[model samples]
Target: MRKLIIGITGASGACYGIRALQMLREIEDVQTHLVISPSGMRTALEEGTGLSGEDIRALADVCHHHKDIGASIASGSFRADGMLVAPCSIKTLSGIAHCYADDLMTRAADVCLKERRRVVLMVRETPLHAGHITLMDQATRSGAIIMPPVPGFYTQPKTIEDLVTQTVGRALDLFDIDHPSVRRWKKECATEA
Candidate 1:
């Protein structure tokens, strides 16, 4: 069974995390472990996700509290294939970059880096300044992938849902998890040619 640790920070794009969780549920033999920051829950509700915080938690096979620093995922010994910080807030990125285990989300991310596991951060910020760029550099040097969920216009998405699905699918691709909904550019180009 492939074990994946998912962290949802207090960023604006809660949909990325929620969509990832929803898609992962359909994949057999893949177990999803989730952790949501306090602000993340608030954002989910405030953004009108149509699901209560508890309902969102139910999508995962296991859920860890953001305050639970002693959770299994916080330890390096707990083996996981990878970790994804979807909608990674700049605050969380700073914490992970500095190796500060102040919260469970950062702690688990730290553990993943130390364990030589893949860590993908779907950072949700724009108009980047020097500080954000520096932290991203630091995180990348520590073996984390800074993946901002930018939409692909070539897919010619007609709805917001299509863009969200494509972004989430690409994030999952980093873990080599195949999401059927992803519209591959190569395939589309090939068909066009």
Candidate 2:
């Protein structure tokens, strides 16, 4: 079974994280370990997911508190395949970039990096300054894939949910997990005229 650590930060796009969880639940082989920052919870409420903290937690196989620094996932020995910080806040990115490991989310990311495991950060901010770029560079240098949740228009999404599914599906693809919602690109071929 592949174990995946999912982190939901306080960034604006909480839907990415939520959709990731919902989609992962469909795959029988993947076990999801979820950790949502306090600000993450607040943002989910502010963004009107219409689901309480309990409702969100119910989506995961296991849920860890953000303050639990000593959780199983915080250690490098834990055999998690990788981690995805959907809608990663700049603060979380800085922590991961600097190896601060102050909380479970960043600490787990640090552990994954130290173990040379795949780490993807979906940074959500826009109009970024040099500092954000620097942080992204540092995280990338440390073996984390910085993936911002930019929608692909080729899918011709008709709803906000469709866009969210496509972005989340791409993130899962990095982990080698195939999500049925992902609309893969297929080139059109023309016959000889």
lDDT of 2 at 7: 98
Q: Clashing pairs in model 2? A: none
TM-score, per-candidate, Cα-based: 0.95, 0.98
Give the range where candidate 2 is weakest over 10 consecutive residues by summed lDDT.
184-193
Off by over 4 Å in 1: 187-193
**lDDT for each candidate structure:** 0.94, 0.96
Clashing residue pairs in candidate 1 are none
Candidate 1: minimum summed lDDT over ten consecutive residues — where? 184-193
Steric clashes per prediction = 0, 0
Task: List all candidate RMSDs to the true structure.
Answer: 2.1, 1.2
Candidate 2, superposed: residue stretches over 4 Å from native: 190-193
